[model samples]
Structures are given as structure tokens and as C-alpha cells.
Target: MNLNIKILNQKEINNMKISKKFTSIFLAGLLSASVAFSTPA
Candidate 1:
């Protein structure tokens, strides 16, 4: 039971890392897109 809990915890941590990375990438894309639109062509 303890091992299972540890495994779940590790998975949760990994998922959190993935979520943060995805969020960062998404925000970066949005920032770039906004800059592109706001910039004068």
C-alpha cells in the first residue's frame, strides 16, 4: 500500500511538471501572437 501511494505521488509530481510546462508554452505562444498582432506591419 505504501509503495502504491509513493508511485501515485511520483505520477502526480510528473503530471504537475507537465502541466506547468504546457502552461508556460501556451502563455509564450499567446504572448508572441499578441505581439505580432500589436506590431505595425
Candidate 2:
């Protein structure tokens, strides 16, 4: 299915990119921390 979407301005696009990058990094760190705590050395 196709949906109509509005275009984003340059500043908005840049903000979106930065937020997504930050979210990925945060998730990765959380995952690593959980694994470290759950697994025995």
C-alpha cells in the first residue's frame, strides 16, 4: 500500500538523522551491558 508523506526540510532531516544515529548507539550499548551481566566469564 502507498501512503502520502510530506517532505522534510534540511534542518528537520538532519535532526532525524542525528536522532536515529544516537538511538542505534544507545541500543547497542544497552545490549552489550545486558549480555555482559548475564554471561559468566
- Top-scoring candidate (TM-score): 1
Worst-scoring 10-residue span by lDDT in model 1: 31-40
Q: Which stretches of candidate 1 lie over 4 Å from their true place?
A: none
Clashes of 1: 0
Supply candidate 2's per-residue lDDT for 34.
98
Per-residue CA lDDT of candidate 2, range 1-41, in tens?
12323334656788999999999999999999999999998
- Cα-based RMSD of candidate 2: 6.0
| lDDT of the structure predicted as candidate 1 | 1.00
Compared with the true structure, the alpha-carbon lDDT of candidate 2 equals: 0.84
Query: What pairs collide in candidate 1?
Result: none
